[model samples]
Target: MPTATRVVCEQLAPTIADLAGNQRLVLETIARDVADGADIVVLPELATSGYVFESAEEARSVALRRDDPFFARVAELLTGTDAVAIFGFCEQSDGDELYNSAAVVTATGVVEVYRKVHLWDRETLVFTPGSAAPPVVDTAHGRVGVMVCYDLEFPEMPRSVALAGADLIAVPTNWPFTDVPAGERAPEVIHAQSSARANGVFIACCDRAGIERGQHWTEGTVIVDQFGWPIDRASGVARATADVFLHLARDKSISPHNDLLADRRPDVYPKGAAR
Candidate 1:
């Protein structure tokens, strides 16, 4: 088990429809985080291609294939380090379909790609929803799970990954700003906190900043501990950093008499509930 893993979530403002510039921004961000000793770095959803597209054709224009050399450049940045980078991208599948996906990358290359299962608002109009479940990849740092924005809002999504033995859940989100009461956190951040506490796993949600196509974002990048408290949160466009023992998440015991996972009454619960 690893001792303490340094995790970073960067809140970047990506320009809409500028694939080259967005890719450059991603590379520079990763390089800087790696130099700063970030074991795991996460970026917002659609980091490669900005969200809020006017049309599907517009999105397809900036979509990248899994084998795009741009990913190689990202891997090159981690050449001698054990660092891992997970970010969202507009993916062009082998077929005519386009999906909102998150890729987990290391020095070796892309390890796993998880397409967004839950699309929010206009996203359904532009991309096809993924059929597969979230994936947990074992890395030198720890077991990292990948999920895109809206997926994290679903309780089952996080629980399934936790049951699969994920130490940290990395979420790449482009959350649109919405109304929140005074002295309260964004609803999205609340969801992250709830999910983390319920599953007893660390969750890092990387959210984007700035307005795109007149749509303001929540800029709610947060790192939550297993106890469901916010470890760190990004203000405006910045990075939230935290050093935590990834192995600690393996223990699901909340109290001496209660174990989060072991105490589940799956047999009596609804059939569609997370097992």
Candidate 2:
């Protein structure tokens, strides 16, 4: 009775400084997910090159152009699959500066690029910040929005897109392991859950896992619904996939009760900030 959207979520252990190997893995994963009946496939952040690059020079060396041969190869694989592939890659721009960027690759072509807006510690030294927020785009599945690693931590990013009419938020992350007591409910995951519940939207957080350059990363990739509940979860570095029906459980009888966006008293809140 519920019309759910099917997506294949992939968790890959990307090898640092190995563009060719990464490309092969991405293509293989795409193929596997497509065969499994995925309407969409989301990969980890900086997927093409592992997240442990030592310097801007290091990141630049492995970064790929939008028109690179590898992207063309990916586009070729996307043909006839009818699945939109969203994945992260280090982008090389005009001045050759690098960006932590994600692209939504449809069967037709690349739809949009959502660059990392909020940079992490080492990332600030390497990549430039994106000034504008990414708007949600209408897709066959629904209205979807994209955000990179650190962007998911900020409420404004998701709030803005949700307010703009996004029904789903696709996040690509590479979270590091910490001693936080929440277990799988890390701050990043909490942020995703809260944002989803507050905005009345679904969230798909695809993260990188395993030891990268000797540092442990969090492997808690999940798909949460409007009630801020996870429908699917991954444990200890493996691939997990699921099909979610948007608006399945949500009915008109359930109105915006704890919704943060709807409850905001913008008149007073915005005035103080404007001053």
TM-score of each: 0.98, 0.91
Per residue, candidate 2 scores C-alpha lDDT tens digits across 1-275 of: 64668866687889988888888898898887877788778899989988989988889988988777776676677788667788999989877678899988877777787788899988999898877687576777777889987898777788788878787888888888766864446778888888888788888889887788897887878888877888887876676676877554233124557444656677767754423
Per-residue CA lDDT of candidate 1, range 1-275, in tens?
Answer: 35789999999999999999999999999999999999999999999999989999999999999999999999999999999999999999999999999999999999999999999988999999999999999999899989998899899999999999999999999999999899998999999999999999999999999889899999999999988999999978899999989898999998999999999998889986753
lDDT of each: 0.95, 0.80
In model 1, what lDDT does residue 190 have? 94
Root-mean-square deviation per candidate: 1.1, 2.4
- Where model 2 places Cα greater than 4 Å from the true spot, the runs are 182-184, 247-253, 256-262, 271-275
Best by TM-score: 1
TM-score of candidate 1 versus the correct structure, residues matched by position:
0.98
RMSD of 2: 2.4
